[model samples]
Target: MIRFENVSVTYEDATETALHHVDAHIPEGELCLLVGPSGVGKSTLLGTVSGLVPHFTGGTLRGRVTVAGRDTRTHKPRELADVVGTVGQDPLAHFVTDTVEDELAYGMESLGLPPGTMRRRVEETLDLLGLNELRDRPIATLSGGQQQRVAIGSVLTPHPRVLVLDEPTSALDPGAAEEVLAVLQRLVHDLGTTVLMAEHRLERVVQYADQVLLLPSPGAPARLGDPAELMAVSPVRPPVVELGALADWSPLPLSVRDARRRAAPLRARLEGRTPPAAPAPAPEAPVLAQTARLTLLRERVTALHEVTLALRAGETVALMGRNGAGKSTLLGSLVGLHAPTSGSVSVGGAAPHRTRPAELLRHAGLVPQEPRDLLYADTVARECSSADRDAGAEPGTCRALVSELLPGIPDGTHPRDLSEGQRLALALAIVLTAGPPLLLLDEPTRGLDYAAKSRLVALLRDLAARGHGTVLATHDVELAAEVAHRVVILAQGEIVADGPTGEIVTSSPAFAPQTSKILAPEPWLTVPQVREAL
Candidate 1:
């Protein structure tokens, strides 16, 4: 259904090619997963299939890319719309309409389908994606997860033969991600639809993939094989695979069930041993931020409701929950983006909402979910310099942080041209340059690979050790387990659970990391913990 023959892509004025001599064939009805490290051109490869690389992105494409037997070189994205549907990393950017129902119908309308067919497809997609109740709601009011579903439903309504999704489940909760993957599985098995997805969260999708495509590095030949075969040598791997490797399991387990079945001996080895304890703040540590009975309403929706919380110095707290569970709202309240309806939010003894921008930066800094929102300069150098000036840091401080967080990103490269993970690293460096007492990161690891995530974990740990309080709102259970001292779960604008990371993650199946799940009843939340235990 999809074929790339001697394909290589290079952006305008770019030194490195995004993809080099890539040759791969994805058969009809197969769910092919594109896996690689951050900035390795996974997105670029996906764009080629939809004719977005050289066509809309102003790049040079050599060789051929054909989808459903149609040459992408001759067809633009709009021309290939009927054959390929692409949903990018940012769902908000994909929406062209205001309401959920309108968004779903927009694609079909663009294709000039019969009104009856459009309506029928819209209804069918709404039901298939579990968006029935939200069909009449405005797109902006929906939670991040809801917006993701709408974005996907919009593309699926057109009934395209090929679906190209970039990080489709990045913003979704575990349960919601499963639902989306299930729909993809149905499309592949029942309808013989071709699905090509690029995702950083391999643990969630690897098991479902019929074939795996590994892009080891930018400008390198792509590898195609069975999931287990590719995973065995892939630099970036899911936690389950890592666990299987650590335990010397003959064949690496892709899914939790398979891993658990092979974990009987490993489980017995750790039966009585306790997992290492996570670090904790001192009992007398000062409070860096506090929220008392906070309530926030947006467009008549109670985003946050009478929520009380506190952040202590030298502590890293992870805020987790399903989509629309108010995790972002809580971060907004702390960062002064949203004012509470009924209660108070204090950061460093001053109200965040009333705090000046300069003052707020000194108190706390926020790296929003959309990393581009905080980036405006044309070049990476300028952005880093601006961050230094804004944070009153040394001239090269921000640049140095960027190097530490994301190396190999050229200083002269346009911020817009960077990959999602590289952009996030730059944004994070901008925030960290301030050296604020409190750090706020929302979904910080969205596009990061395992190596980048490990670097971020180390950075967060160092910050907490230096008495900087950190609050991370994320759907990454693995990240929470790695860096979070305490995990706070929110649901429907209320705090549902708050405790130590080990305690909170192990108690809930949905929120637990792969290591915790594999070593059930043992409280091991990470591979390192398991390794240390043995």
Candidate 2:
């Protein structure tokens, strides 16, 4: 059991405490989920368990933290390594080996385990994560999702009693994410391992949690309870499930299958309801920002083939594909971060590769997949205004625009100090303030809650409506359905499918249909659409 008795942590060089005087207990072998908007010290709480809070990361501490009856204050991270294993959001930062097989065996080898036991454990871990095919492959060559699994596998092979994971599925596509979750579920059930995970993607893991620890916001207290009970009160509640409850359904459905089952009767009752008249149809043959035979090469690999595509003005396009299938690379090519080897990539009648990085900022605004690397300023407001200075725009205008998107935070606070959701919002506001005609967002909703996602959808929809072309590379099919007018699927660095939102989602096996589509897989991407379709 992991217990915190009035534990409070305050990092040096910060004015406020990260975690308040908090008391919580995680029972043995319980699949406890640590959830909140972001930054509410969820990660800090997990760090305390593994001796990261006061040991690796120096911080003022009060009270005590005990794991399995062992006092955490007495044991540093290296001392607790045998009992606790942790996987952070950034997996690559913790890697100790170059290959998957070697990485899995590194932990056991460090503990002085015999060669035979280490080999067996490595084999078991590889099979558990379904990474046997890539056992000998280079760690750098693996996709983001695969790397996340390898990180988990590397730690799990040590047979640690407690496994702490931070946002494990934030970087994964739908199919790959399911595989990782399945492996984690098996660990809790079959190995009797205690799991404590902090994540923003609640819809994927809420049903599996035995206990939910909900934090309100930064520097605030956290609430703990059964997963289902907490979901009802959560500000970032899952969309379909929340809609089901709003519509007065009995025993709220947690998964798509359960949602379908619950909605079946409702569909029958509402079958005869008349549909509202259709709104004026958008123009046929929409004029898109055309890319004529675009080709890109990264060393020997072809990042993008001679691809011809069109992204219509005032329309949202979802760019979907397997990881390492060049989703980010394509976004980079369009923003002049990477020059194409052949052909041309254009946005708003100008070639991005030919334009200067500063000049390109005016035509297309890009939000990279990893938001941390993009942030350089000390404060949130300063980060937003950095773009203004770069583009020769007024700082006052930039501050006003950022305030409009994210309201609660003061302009003087540090950007890194804010929650993950808030940081994402701040970054997006900066990008949009540049007044670009085209926008390229790569996994912009990665660490956000449902509430933040809703705000993002509204913002993107408004931007598209205002005649700004938008392209979003994302794993959240649900977000794509709600905001995007069109969907394009990429496989092995080539366009495999492209069509309207409804058609591509329903047809693709690689893609999991959105909740709205799962409820009603035709002519719609929302709950209202499902209700009306019935």
Candidate 3:
């Protein structure tokens, strides 16, 4: 269905080749997963398949890429739209229409499909992606995750033979992500559609992949083969594969069920001991932020309702739930992006909504779901320098933070040219330069690979230890298991559960980390915890 022949890509004004001699093939009706670290040309490779590289991105393509036997070099993205449905990393950029239902039907209308067929496919896609309640909502009013689902449904309604998705589940919550993946599975198995997806959250999709495409580094040779074989040697790994390696299991198990079948003795070894987790904040700790009976409305929809919460010094909290469950709303309220409809929100002894931007900088800083929003400077150096001046910090503080999170990023590179994860690291560094007492992150790990995420985890742990309070809204359960002292679950614009991380995540099957599920009857939340226990 897809083939890459001696593929090499070099962008205009770029010294190093973005992709170097990547030769690969995918047969029809197969689901291929593209795996690599940040800035390693995974997106570039996907762009080739969709004809976005040389056609739209102004890059030089030295080799041929074909989808369904049509050469991408000879065809543009629109010319190949009938056979290929491509969803890139940013959902907002993918939408051409304003409303959910209209966006879903737009692709089919472009294809000149009959009105009846378009309507039927739109309805089927809405049900398949669980988007019925949001059919009429403006795309801007919906949450990030909801927009992502709509973006996917739009392409899906066209019924393209080959579906190319980049970070398809990045914005989705655990349940929503599963639903989206299930829809992709049906497209591959029942309908014989070819799906090529690139995702950073491998734990959620690795088990479902039919074949794995491993790109070890930037511009390296691509490796494509059985999922199990590639996962064993891939630089990045999911929790299941990491655990299998820790236990020295031969060939490594790809799913929880397979790992469980071989874990009788391992369970015996860990029967009496529990995994160690970061302790929750002390009751007497100084309050950095708090919300009292807060209610917020957006587009007449109750985004947050009668919610009361608190964040204390030296604490890291993870806000989690299904898509559009008020997690982002709460974060916005704390950072003054959204004023509450009723009730009160205070940060650093002042109401965030009423505080000025300069004063609010001392109280809190936010790295939103879209990292690009916080960055406006042209180059990496300028952004960092500007952040330093705004925060009154030393000149190199932001640059050093970026180095710690993502090393080797050039100072002169345009922010737009950086990968999603690289852009996020720059945004985070800018936020941290202010040295705010409270830090807020929405889906901070969206594009980060395992190694990048580990650096962030360590950095957050260090920040908490230095008496800063952190609240991050996220769908990455593995991250919460590793770094959070507390976990708060919200649903339908209300707080449903809040407690120690291990207690809250382990109790809920849908939100539990992979290691916790494999080692059930115990509250183990990470592979590192299991390794430490042994």
Candidate 4:
């Protein structure tokens, strides 16, 4: 269904080809998984299949590309829309309608489908994606994960023969991600649809892929082969694969079930052994932020309800919950973006809502879900320079932080030109340069690959060691297992569970990491834990 003929893409002013000369074939009805580190041209390659490279992105395509037998070079994106359904990393950019139901119907309307057929598809999609409850909600009001599902449903309703998704489940919670992936699986098995997906969270989708397509690095040819064969050599792999390697399991396991099936002897070896204790703030550590009975409402909807939480110096807390469950709202309240309907929130001994903008920088700083919200400069260097100026830091302070978090970023490259993970790293560097007593990050690992995420974990650990307080709101359970000392789970704008990282995630099946699930009854949360135990 999709074919790349010696494809290579070079954007205007780019120093290197985003994608090197590559050739691969994705037969019809196959779920092809694209694997690569961030900014290595996964997105650029996906654009070629959907004809968005040269047509919409102003890049030069040197080799031929085709989708459903139509050459993408000759066919524009709109021309191939009927045969291809593309969902990019950023979901908000894909919406044209205000409400959930309208957005789903709009795509079919564009295709000039019959009214009855459109209505039937809309209902099917809403139910298939579990968006029936959100059908009437305005797109702007939905949470990031909810918005992601709506964006996906909008495309699926078109029922294109080929589906191209970039980070489709990046914003979704565990349950929602499974539902969406199951829907895609159904499409491939029952409807004979083709899916080409690129995702950073391999643990969630790698098991479902029939073929793995890898863009190893910049200026490197792509490789297409069996999932297990490619994954054994892929730099980016899921926790199960990592564990399989750690234990020397032949033919690496791709899913938790497969890993668990082979973990009996390993589990016996780990009996009575304890994982490292989660990090904790010192008893004498100062309290940096406190929310006392905080209640917040937005547009007559309660975003946070009577949530009382506290963060101490040297503590890292992860705020986790399903989409639209008040995680982002709580982060917003910490940064003074939302005024609580009742109760109070304080950072560094001052109410965040009452603190002045310049003063708030000294107290706390927030890197929101949309990193672009904090970035205004044109070039990467200018953004760092501006961050230094705004934070009252010495020259090169922010640049050094950027170099640590996101190395190899060009000084003159546009901030908008960077990949999703690169952009987040830049935004994080800008915020961290302030050196605030408290740090707040919402969905910090959205587009970051494993290597980038490891750097982030190290950076956050360093910050915590230096006595900085961090409140991270994320759906990446593995990330929480790695960095968060404590976790707070919210539901329907209320805090339901708050405990240490190992206890909370391991106790809950929905929130447990892959290793934890595989090593169940052992209380393991990560590959390192299992490795250490053995």
- How many backbone clashes does every candidate have? 0, 0, 0, 0
The global C-alpha lDDT for each of the candidates, from Candidate 1 onward, is: 0.91, 0.77, 0.92, 0.92
Q: Per-residue alpha-carbon lDDT of model 4 for 1-534, expressed as tens digits?
A: 899999999999988888998899999999999999998999999999999998988978998998888999899899999999999988889999999999999999999999999999999999999999989999999999999999999999989999999999999999999999999999999999999999999999999999999988777788999999999999998999999999899899999989989999889989999898867889789999899999999989988999999899999999999999999999888878898899999887888788898998898999988898888999999999999998889999999998888788999999888888899999999999999989999999999999999999999999999999999999999999999999999999999999899989998888999989998898789997777766
Tens digit of per-residue lDDT, candidate 1, span 281-389: 9989999999999999988988888899989999999999998899988888887888788899999899999989889888889998889999999999999999999
- For all predicted structures, in order, the TM-scores are 0.98, 0.90, 0.99, 0.99
Model 3's TM-score against the true structure: 0.99
- The TM-score, computed over Cα atoms with residue i paired to residue i, of candidate 1 is 0.98
Residues 1-534, candidate 3, lDDT per residue (tens digit)? Answer: 999999999999888899988888898899999999888888998999899988999979998899998999999999999999999899999999889999999998899999999989989998999999999989998889999999999999999999999999999998999999999999999999999999999989999999999999886798999999999999999999999999889889999999998877788889989776576567899999999999998888889889999899999999999899989889888878898899999998988888998899899999999999988999999999999999999999999999999997999999988988999999999999999999999999989999999999999999999999999899999999999999999999999999988889999988899998998887688999999998
* Model 4 stretches astray by more than 4 angstroms: none
- The residue ranges of model 1 lying beyond 4 angstroms of the native Cα positions read none
Clashing pairs in 3: none
After superposition, which runs of candidate 3 have C-alpha atoms over 4 Å from their true positions? none
- Residue 403 Cα positional deviation in candidate 4, in Å, after optimal superposition: 1.7
Worst 10 residues of 2 by lDDT: 272-281
What value does the lDDT take at residue 370 in candidate 1? Answer: 86
lDDT of 1 at 390: 85
lDDT of 2 by residue, 43-72 (tens): 788889999888987888789999888898
